[model samples]
Target: MVKKQDQVTHNAKPTAVESRGGKSTIAIKGTFPEKYFAKKATMTITPAIKNYNGEIKQLTPIDFQGEKADGKGQIINYKEGSGFNSVQNIPYDPAFGKSILVLNSTVKKGEKEIKLNEKEIGEVNMSTKRQDIDPKLVYKNQTSDGTNYYFSEHNYIPNNLVVKTATIFFDFNSDKLNWNLPFNQKEENKQALSELFPFLMDYDSIQSIDIEGWASPEGELRRNQQLSNNRSLVGKKWFEKELESYLKKQSKETKSFMKRLTYKLYDKGEDWDGFINALKNANIEDKDKIINVIQSQATKIQKEQQIQNMIAIYDEIDQKILPCLRRSYFKISCVENLRTDEEIMRLVNISPDSLTKNELLYAASLTNDMEMKKKIFSKAIELHPEDYRGYNDLACIKVAEGKTDEAKKLFENANVLKSNNDVVLNNLGIMSYQDKDYGKSEKYFNESQKAGMDQSKNLALVKDTIYTIDYQTKPDIEETANDDKTKKQKSEDD
Candidate 1:
């Protein structure tokens, strides 16, 4: 029997994740390109931030960044929050058959509008901050003005598309993140650091952040104090140096920077007030004299009420707040006028899913631009051949542009790899229909239906079209025999 924990289908593909607690719900509905369905996926939640303490009631709102296409999308909204809990769902590609998720927690708000299909959803109202309007939606070969998902040929279908949302906790002290060593002192960590620095640099727009270093009280008080202080200084320098290097690589044209990067360094030497006090009550340490001494110092620091004095008080609580006190981070401020899509896309192709290499190729066919479609399709084929989406998508482009012979060859290749995919069967049927081979067309159409490409209405339309082909091909019989039979029948009736 499968265990309760096993119900999540750890090995099976995941579509999305859900919040563990709290009643807030997430609803996702989006459209895909015409005649296409997304592959099975395992959705992983990456929590970027969390507020377990429940001290903060609301998080800052910010636009969550995601791309339907591998590299051809943008984050064009104004507000995403920096709240305590932010969760993202990352999907993997089907063609590559790899499992991956990039769930991140952000301390931001979730109300941001994206321009899809020239309509907007999840957008904030202008007069009031509350969201009041349903933005437009665009899906494969169709657009929704708000009430309907309409196809290009004016056909309408129910808005059956739904997206799953989940909340995940992002581990900060992890040895590795997203298969990259986040804090390791190796090549993997270097790459992780590289990724981190870009986001950290963005925070430099803030006034400054406080950097307090701490060391366990294992040795002499004075020695531990200085050691902690030195460590903070080292971290500050590393951050500063990395920032400078990143700025140098930005662009030759920019001569100015937004905010000055700075940090305040402090060290709390050998003072385990928080930890030691807890231990004292538990009789783990019989150091009344020591506790008394530390309490006096803590009381004095609390009275100061200055930033420097606060650091001292904060240090006193490090024992009780091991996670917060041992942490090293800087406050970053938001800036206006960030880089454009053309600029970011220039750096790398934004993948639809980290695990899915083939899906990126599937996205290539979605591109209407011929040049881009060819480039993405080639990359997809290079990555994986076991999957038929790549071959079929590329073949689709051929059929769209009237390259029937080339499309037929591509279909043949795809059939060899996967005989059951409806997409390939449907395309093959359409190709045969267009080629004026009525018998071949009927065979392909039947095959498509057998393969579960069962659109009765579409099949009916195809059947009607066959009559047009017959009338064109058998013009002599239509012009002579059909007219004589009709004339005889009418004369008899009269």
Candidate 2:
């Protein structure tokens, strides 16, 4: 008996091959590499001998120096020969789209050199008139490969830059926090605080602690003042609670010993401790001096705390910085458990609510996760919509999502409630421009510019729009094509 023959056909889908313009042309998995670089492009880096920290400074450049076998270590190519030499000119390809080709290098005091790879192709050097660009580009600098270089990658920052940093780097304004935390968590104040916990715990000698809060020189004086106070208190309180809790988990003897002689807390509730302490330590080793210091410090700290309490209820002053301002601190009383105290405090400080909304918003903005930010800001808005800051913050999320209409309305509401708010006006202009309403955009942008907004680029953008409008309105190919086909034009010519 003849068996029925089975028929089969291979109708597999094609693998996708990316086009130059960033789209898939065909589909077939094995035909394409798992990943490919974006088209390479050239960029020029200029070097100059500028006075750096009162000394003639030059850029120490290095080539790709790692072993080629490491895949990442290969010297793809250098614009010129590699050596410790003055970089007169170097051409290199800008990082292959997002793929960075980093060359680790180092520099010496009073030494200057320049190096180039296939990525660097040009250089322009000028006087310190270009200081602004340095701040914009050189958020961090580093040294590697025997030369000084601006760190283009986050991981390279600490290794390259050197400055007058305290031994306790992360201790308030110390350079320690400059190091990038795990998973970009450094941008998150809470995460930073969270990370700070273990550090504090490690320090067993810290029997007392003080946290002073500061504010940027913006916003209402009263609000800023109150915010700084709250933040100090909250920060201290969190640290104390966390330390106590952690201590409670220790051996009974340890816990009892720590409790009896470990905890001492003080929150000047504002930025008054330093000033009062200075006055107290003002070279008078007498009781009168101590009394004066106590009186002055007590008065300022008490008044600041009272002001913060009032501000907490002031709906109109609902700045997101309030929580940062409303911070309390843990001041360890005795020298014992100081290490435990610090560790516990750091852990407390790192908790989710340890940071202010502004900090969270700033951190969220750095990540690719709009949903996370939206989830956070959205809830904040719902809880505090009447406050200008909450609405403004929510509007920022809307803007990120390309919801111009909604963002514009929100900005308008924010502006109406807080007329002096520059962020609302600036964002309103941004939304208007994004919506292609150049006229409205220009108006808002001008208002922002006149208000001394920090973003000079916005003013330039408004001018660019005006120029674009002029060029677009001028007769062009489309207008000529319409004229050529129009009967009215032909009749008028005849």
Candidate 3:
């Protein structure tokens, strides 16, 4: 908006606002008319903008002194006025759309002062604010875009190898695993055992099963050794029986997991460490003396007698302490059954419902085709409507299509599903930016960054609008904006 009044002539009348040198600027260039200045007169020129809400933003004023006037100001000649070029950068605000720019001038000579009529520079055009940043998406592995921008994605399952451990306990002086005993009756043991079949049936490939059995040092060393070995053998046999039963129930098409399974059995006889730890932890009568007698005694028979004597003195050692020493442990190593890229792509279109949510999202990520991504995301939302990932990712697709209205609705839906989510908050920020609501967009980006998604780049982009001037200043230029700055700004973007 650079058109000048009848009294003023401008270098150029820019129709649109532009971003240059990473700053949003509105530059005006012109010169005062010759013989316009009085010998003892001082003039003040002010530029301002009237926004959509009728609020005015006044820029820093420029001053000029007459030849007879004192002070360090641009001395205007009485015969020939000075040239000027001003570049005033202001952050982009929502209300800046269709704003008007005006110049105010005043002159003071002797005891008299005159206020000139307001000059319309022109309507400031905000067309340069329109930009497509191509916002990064959600639900995937977050990556950097060379400029420290976090590009969020959803296909985060890099590897599915897992080592799961489950524990089962036994009864006092028993080689058998008693299901009714409180130790053995824990739901975790049953849950852990039950989980193995399904993983073996389809989900994962069972690599190895490590089983360990331990017995308390209450019996003879040789007897405890045999007991530990028998208990571990029982655990292996029971697991194999459970696998066989599951195999009978499943379809023959499923792979035979037993053939793939490798068993490593360890019989840890006489848990002396367990006994000492239990004794140290227990709050019992003569606790110190009992531990000393057990740990320092010479013979196993003597230690057993001392333990028996302590058991008589305190039932805590026999009931609560000893039960924990006898136990069976298992470690199951498994690798997830991952489908190939070709398989996922074929199944995504043919029978999408059969694919899992992660597989569908991964399928969408595999292709550069937007239409394919749209189809995959559509199915993801359809099959898993409750998941926010599908909604957010589908909205990103709509945004890429320039379907802002549709994208906004989907983004809102994602917010509803997972309130204050970082990825959704960032997308919402972009929506606000598109709607010309920079203030609201800033708040959302700040929240997004705080919530773990980095939106700093977006924040700076929204706040700083760059402006550049390719044309030279006009003959009417009265003042340059940055007189102290000798070097001109040339942006890489220009």
Residues 1-494, model 1: lDDT tens digits: 01121221111111222222211222222222221211211112221111233211222222332323222222212222111223223221122122111122221123422221111112110110111222221223453332111111111122222211111111222211122322233464345446644564433234444555554443345555665666566556665666667777875222355234455777654335544554365432334654555456654343222223333544533333232223233333344223333432342265433424523543443445766765665555566677665566667666556676886887778877888655566566556555555457567667767877553643553454210000011244346778999999999999
Off by over 4 Å in 1: 1-359, 362-366, 465-494
Model 2 whole-model lDDT (C-alpha atoms)? 0.38
Which candidate number maximizes lDDT?
3
The window of 10 residues in a row where model 2 has the poorest summed lDDT is: 1-10
In the order shown, the candidates' Cα RMSDs to the true structure are 33.1, 30.2, 9.6
TM-score of each: 0.26, 0.28, 0.64
Kindly list the per-residue Cα lDDT of model 2 for residues 149-198, writing each as its tens digit. Answer: 11112121111222110111112211122234232232544454444444
Candidate 3, residue 278: Cα displacement in angstroms equals: 8.9
How well does candidate 3 match the true structure in TM-score terms? 0.64
lDDT per residue (tens digit) for residues 24-113 in model 3: 566677677777766787878787777768798788686877889864568878688778777776555556655667778777777877
For residue 484, model 3's alpha carbon misses the true position, in angstroms, by: 40
Residue 244 shift from truth in candidate 2, angstroms: 17
Please give the lDDT score for candidate 3.
0.72
Score residue 102 of candidate 3 by CA lDDT: 75
